[model samples]
Target: MIEPSPVKKEPIGKLISCVYRTQLKRMSRSLGEYGIGGGGQYSFLKAILMTPGTTQDQLTVKLKFDKATTARSVKQLEAAGYIKRSADPEDRRSHRLYPTPKAVEFQPVLQALLDESNARLTRDLTPEEEDQLIVLLQKLNLED
Candidate 1:
């Protein structure tokens, strides 16, 4: 009897999606301790922390998030008291996102959680593999 072709491998997109789902689940669990319930808030917080004056439009493009998602998240973060928005000085209709004192305090904690998640996810990978994976992932992200 012929061996069933060793079971066809999953497509790259499916495999990457599985990895993303698992990572996000782990991140959510880790961030829960800090009152961050998933839904990509961690990313918003981190990006704002890194670039305090970033505009919502800038974030939408930088984060590759839809405008609606970005708007909703900005509202949610504001409600959570982690971010504050101000009208852009040059653009009458644009608003810039800034991290609150609370968000500043939470930055390190969020970073630690992210680092732990990354380590856990890559526990089986060698240093070289980890570097290569990150480079390849960035390449994919940068591709139009």
Candidate 2:
């Protein structure tokens, strides 16, 4: 009979992708109640809230999202009353983004939801482990 091969360790990219997909599912479910779409929509909203008058191009770069994605998220947010866009005076082609009053009022709730999501993600890890993971992830981020 032929002997079976030993199982190799999972690739780092596969593990990260799995975790990311799970996180997105959980976040999407929580954000649905607030009419926020899944897959980086909340991230865009948070950025706009934190920095008003930011242009789409700026967000595309800052958030590491494609220009098409930035445009779609901005459109959805505007339709949902979470943000507003105005033409830039110096650049007619560019539009600056601002959070609407609705989004401003909802900011605290959004933050609380994000906090809960993060807490759930790290529930299995000790404080030291979580800290170490964060450090490692930051190091990985530096590669980009």
Candidate 3:
């Protein structure tokens, strides 16, 4: 009978952080290759695509970003011809986000990149294993 080898453990939080940073760097490089520099801009564009007419406050909540950061991202995307903001019908003070045609046109490419990244990251995992890992990660992130 063979005894199990000692389980080597490191701080899970630090490991997760490093993984995130590395992935972010890769994403930033890819976006730069496509002439988009800001991660916030990519996220904001995704939010607009997912929820058209979303207000700045809604985007702030959905993106887990502060108001100023959300505003800046929206502004930059608008300047880049990727998005537009219109005055909210219900609240004149609020602005609703909308993806421009150019932004909508990029959706397929964006999705392809995401799928490729996922495939690369889970190269050795089966679909069920990937699903289980997602569930486990969510469980670890549970908050009251």
Listed in order, each prediction's TM-score against the native is 0.89, 0.90, 0.84
Give per-model CA RMSD. 4.2, 5.5, 3.3
lDDT of 3 by residue, 1-144 (tens): 224458876787888887767666766677766655565467778888998998889988877888898888888788878888899888899888898898899888877876776687788988888888788787895343
The best candidate by TM-score is 2
| Deviation of model 2 at 59, angstroms | 1.1
Candidate number that wins on lDDT, 1 or 3 = 1
lDDT of candidate 2 over 27-143, digit per residue (tens): 889999889998689999999999999999999889888889999999999999999999999999999999999999999999999899999999998898899888888778533
Task: Spell out the clash pairs found in candidate 3.
Answer: none
| lDDT, residue 130, candidate 3 | 86
Models ranked on lDDT? 2, 1, 3
lDDT for residue 143 in candidate 2, whole number 0-100: 32
- Measured with C-alpha atoms, the lDDT of residue 65 in candidate 1 is 83
Q: After superposition, which runs of candidate 1 have C-alpha atoms over 4 Å from their true positions?
A: 1-7
Which one is best on lDDT?
Answer: 2
- RMSD value for candidate 2: 5.5
User: CA shift at 61, candidate 1, in angstroms?
Assistant: 0.7
Residue 20 in model 3: lDDT: 68
